[model samples]
Target: MSFPKYPEYKDSGVEWLGEVPAHWGVKQLKYLVTCLDGQRIPLNGVERYSKQGSVPYWGANKIMDYVDEAIFDEELVLLGEDGAPFFDVGKPVAFHSSGPVWPNNHIHVLRPGDSAWVKSIVYGLNATNYIDFVEGSTRDKLTQSRMMSIPLAWPPHDERNHIDSFLDHETARIDALVEEQQRLIELLKEKRQAVISHAVTKGLDPDVPMKDSGVEWLGEVPAHWNVVKFKYLIAEFEQGWSPQCDGDQAETLDEWGVLKVGCVNYGVFDPTENKRLPDNLEPRPELSIRKDDLLISRANTRDLVGSAAHVPMDYPKLMASDKIFVVRLHQRICRSRYAVVYLFGKGVRHQIELQATGASSSMLNIGQGAIRELWIPLPPDSEQDRIVHELEKREADFAALEQETVRHMRILNERRSALISAAVTGKIDVRGWQADQQSRQSEILMAAETRATYG
Candidate 1:
């Protein structure tokens, strides 16, 4: 997996460039490419919507939409002028696009002097450290002058082609592996949701007698189970107060903080998603969060409205916001964990979405009355405990698998970035590199065997 270093090296005079192969030449980026920023035209959302068509409308980082007109029709590289992930080394700052496309003013367009060098230039720009060149307080901006003055190391024409070919082949392989891991993570999420939905709606006993619950969505529950409105199990519920707070989160437990709606957006409590209360405002001790407190987001996007989470522990300094509701369940009739599982089920989620209302799609609110009217199937207290324990075990297993897959993806992405930096900077020589035919054949055979076994 390790590459060979250059046989001879020479200082490039530039610190970031460091050293290059003895035979390589170094020059500023302006001399190697022509800036085509003047050709870019900016389009607003409404204008683009009216002119929707086949051509891509590019923003700083990605395609924002498709428009009816084309601006440039040649091979070129587009670099983010602002709003790009310049500090994230694993992300790309520049990308190559061909054929007809319309780029917005937020991107800087460049046409390489040599058509063959388009891809190589993209890799080189992406690998460079932009910390010293970018500016701006809110968003990093790569000015045209700073971009043009970037130092670059280049090899002979034929060697540049070889480097491009080597990188294209190797990066594609790493990307494929990353994609497989991503797909596995998504599948695990689907499986986890399915397991929760089935367990909460139907008892673990498959042969249990079934009876109509009168409610269409409740369907047929176990003969002994009772289908009742959510209000029956809720002993009490209260909305919190919102005070103007600092933009940053409370750094220490001693500092008072107000929870944001996003604290339970994913159905898990995130204590860190809070804003610090200003010194001028008095803390409300009565609204302080307590252990096992059930919190639900009262206002959020439609999909996240009515999202709920059970506070695992107490945070005396943290209080719920006006957009959140704190609910206390009747412990004798329902277990907190069991109620959470039922609320997260697909059937209950559908009801929440249907009842939510707002002026805009981005912000929706669910009223307390709507939440109380939602139906839930109730089981014996002992049966509720059993279901929660089984679900906890399954969730642990799924979490471990997902964490491992995500870690593997991180490693692959880091390897890819390192390889590109080494090759483009002449730290490694790739002029003699070629795709390994035998290794590729072995991979194909292994993939086929896996499909056969799984199918």
Candidate 2:
């Protein structure tokens, strides 16, 4: 529903703050709050954090590693200093903190002179388009100097509380609806994985006799299937080449693009995950990608290492990077689909998780020898083709459903941002806006649900 506007309005001197309630005054942050930028103690020196430690600690936009003791025991607003899309309304710039808390240097900590000002200022800062205050080209950085200069429309104390209380209840309702959509997206993904895992290990014929495939992960498969080492099924398995190229200058040009390891990270082939080669660079012929070639990541984070994707079509100039392996199954192995599904299947993914090695916790690697040695259930040529055909049909169906859910979530986020901006910016007065939690919750979800159903 469209919210009511103030009965009287007057122009505010600031450009972004056009008009506000007649009595409302425009005030700079410097007058209303004390900017404390020196209280920060870096998280690197401490083992415990504010969230996990004796007190609460805040970073740029989240509760990161906490610190030992609570430095500030008052109400404050946190404006992110870096590492966020400040211009994007979907990612909020301002957040509230109360009680004993320690904020890192990555945020501008503000203790408003009046405690009652806390929520109104936070809502105002969140509603503000940070494109006007934020700096830096590669990453956004909001400094204390710029933050103090920004102005917010200040209403009366009673009106401030009303606005604050109104938003607290309303935003929570919006947040709950968004949370439900997020949970559904995750459930859909899990179901997709389960469907493929079941189809590959157990043939479509559920009544068919089952036998232990001998592998620990693959408990039982059709009696006729053979368990074999990964090496025997492939004609060639080679790691991709690493060519010297400037990351800053690299583009996705047609003539000289090299596949980055990201090509396999998405669970499907993404050719856009390639970098343009240097002018002088010439890649070897074997490094070029063909339609049936299967790309597998050899080095990445714990979860993505050994991620595999079969090339759906030929990409002539694209060469796999050193972080991935290019595999060509033997001609006798029809339609590399069976092997592709088996490698990405839940059972084999678990194996990859266990086998991936790394010098550090963050980075992981899988050796070619380890990949070749891994065991897999090998179905006959004809059976492999049949399984591939069935999986392709199921894959298309699930992909459409997933895309719709993703689109719905995007729409909900945009709506949430617009609603907050309108309430705080005097574009709409929500002082009298109220709804039972159930109806508001359903309203938010239904808007997105209807879109999903229609689209």
| Candidate closest to the true structure, highest lDDT | 1
* Candidate 1 TM-score to native: 0.80
**Distance from true location, Cα of 75 in model 2, Å:** 4.8
In order, what lDDT does every prediction score? 0.84, 0.76
Which 10 consecutive positions of candidate 2 have the poorest summed lDDT?
446-455
Model 2, global lDDT: 0.76
Candidate 1 segments exceeding 4 Å error: 1-3, 32-76, 80-83, 98-116, 135-145, 215-218, 235-244, 282-287, 298-306, 322-325, 350-370, 440-455
Tens digits of per-residue lDDT, candidate 2, 1-455, equal 43556888898887776777788888888988898878876564324411255576777888764545787888998888888557764667788888888887888889889888988888888777667888987678888888898889887787778778777776777788778878988887788778888978897888989899888878998998787888887788888888886464235445667788887874688887777777787767678889888788999877788888889888777888899998888847545667777776777888888888765434678888867887877677888888888988988998898888877777777666666666666666767665553454556444323211221
Which number leads on TM-score? 2
| Residue 206 accuracy (lDDT) in model 2 | 88
Q: Write the per-residue lDDT of candidate 1 for residues 266-316, one digit (tens) a residue.
A: 668999999999999999999998877889999987778998988888899
Clashes of each: 0, 6
